[model samples]
Target: MSNPSSKPIGLEIDLLETQGGKVPLEYFHKLISQLQKNHSLDHLSASPASAGEFDVVYIILSKGTLYEETETNAYECIIIDGWSCWPAGFAYLLVPPNRRREKANISGGDNGPSDTADIKIALLPIAQTRGFGRFVIRTLLSHAFDALGIRRVTASILCPIQPSHSVAQKKQVGFNTKQLCWIFEKFGFKFEGISRGALMSMSVVEGEEPVWHDVHRMSMLITDYFQEKRSLSLSAMRSFSREFPLKVVQQSPWEIMIQRQEKEKHDVESWSKRPNDASANDACGNDGEASDDETVLGGDEISEK
Candidate 1:
């Protein structure tokens, strides 16, 4: 089987340039129109293809440091095509080294400060359902960790106030419940303090809220019960046997050598008690001659009678 990393997945990333020329508004408008028709950007209060809706754009267009690794730094924009179709794809922006400290403290410690080039991912609404969201995420992570020398990257998924949070938890994305109380908190994105039951509110269409509490409780209960069962099974197995499993099954090397030495000693003693081979052979020859002589004499006596 081929390694998954070696496969030619063919994703192209480009840096957006802010100087010398402007992207025609019509291009963005068309892109946004397509996004609105197919996706749920309204929940996040974001318009398709607009810089205003994306955090990555602010870092790229204003900062002028983001660039595609595969392409020359000279090229300002990249056009991605010729792959599986998805509603939403990600745009990556590289954060310069000088600015990373100012941006966010991702993990604690100054242990080997990360290079200034950081990546920020912006999700397009059109790329959401066709598994593009996950694909982009994986691809970006691969690039960041493998190619770009980046230690960290951040992205947000907008979650509905209730049951949708469960999906986020299932996906293992960070969630901040306190951020959920704030009206302006970015959907699926939190500054910090995210945990399994923390809710982050994003706009939701009116309907029956999802029953996440049941799922959460069930997840915990199942985990606890399985752990208890595993512990009991292990204890029972251990108590059922008096000897260590290894000791009961096989002799140690030292014990095997000692047994062999004792067997050799017994054989030597038994051989010493037995008569010598030469003496036994001589006694057999003498006995055979005596028997022959007795047979001949008996035959002569019978004939004389």
Candidate 2:
């Protein structure tokens, strides 16, 4: 990321971000299209691209970093991280009109914010299981919570997003859509109501072609997401402490000398508070009075003199 003034290379020059917690719908579309062009490594056999369906996407390199292919350089940070394919994905929040507070002007059109938005991820084969998708989703949630001040973000895993080779032909093994759902659930997204056969095929399906599959909607509140993250961090710290006990510090020579001096000063103060007679009694056990033993010793000393 560059200074907020400097424009990111891949992003459009005029893409507008909203005051409330979301990318404006139009600007969001522009970014999604840009990702589709630059990072979407969809195979030919994959189901036809559906940009309208998914609002967020992501692409992470299996190794090494990639630079943005650009004509000029207003942005200095051109390197896309190998670990997180962040610039690829998109997230949306949809809210009722009553809940909206964001306002922005884009393409000479002004718009207010909404409560809910959809997020999607488009992964290259190398980016899929390395937990890159999880990273993208988590980043989007952070943006929604901190930047957009959103109530919740939604995720829908439609069957159409799956490539045909993995699902039908089984040429490659792929994670089930519900399994993907669990990843977000682990991040505190709730398993919302499901829409069975909600995804109707826009094209005519002949013979054994499957048209519709269940779509799962997962959602997370801003507060709950942050709270869950804090809890997990605390839990991890506790577990680590249990596994590796903390060692007491070894004091330096100066610190040891200072501690000994303080102890001696305390002892002096305690001794000064005691009465002289009490101290003598404690030391000689005569209560500051001469007893028969003392008299005998004095008489013996006189006779010797």
Best by lDDT: 2
Candidate 1, residues 1-305: lDDT per residue as tens digits? 22222322433333224412233344334434544554433223223343321123321111122333564542233233333222133344444443344345555555444443333333443222333333443454455445544544443334334444476564443233222223112111224322343333433456855332110110112233335446656766676564446454788999999999999999999988967467755655664355555676784465642
What is each predicted model's overall lDDT from 0 to 1? 0.38, 0.51
Candidate 2, which ten residues in sequence have the lowest lDDT sum? 73-82
Q: How well does candidate 2 match the true structure in TM-score terms?
A: 0.47
- Candidate 2 displacement at residue 139 in angstroms: 1.4
Model 2 misplaced regions, further than 4 Å: 1-114, 161-175, 202-210, 248-305
Per-residue CA lDDT of model 2 for 1-305, tens digit only, reads 12222323332111123333223445445444554564342211123234322222322222333345563521122222223222333333333333332332224422545566556556533334545555555666776677767677777765434334445543232245656678778888899877777775433357756565467788877778789878877887787798899999999999999999999999999988956455655665766677667787884465542
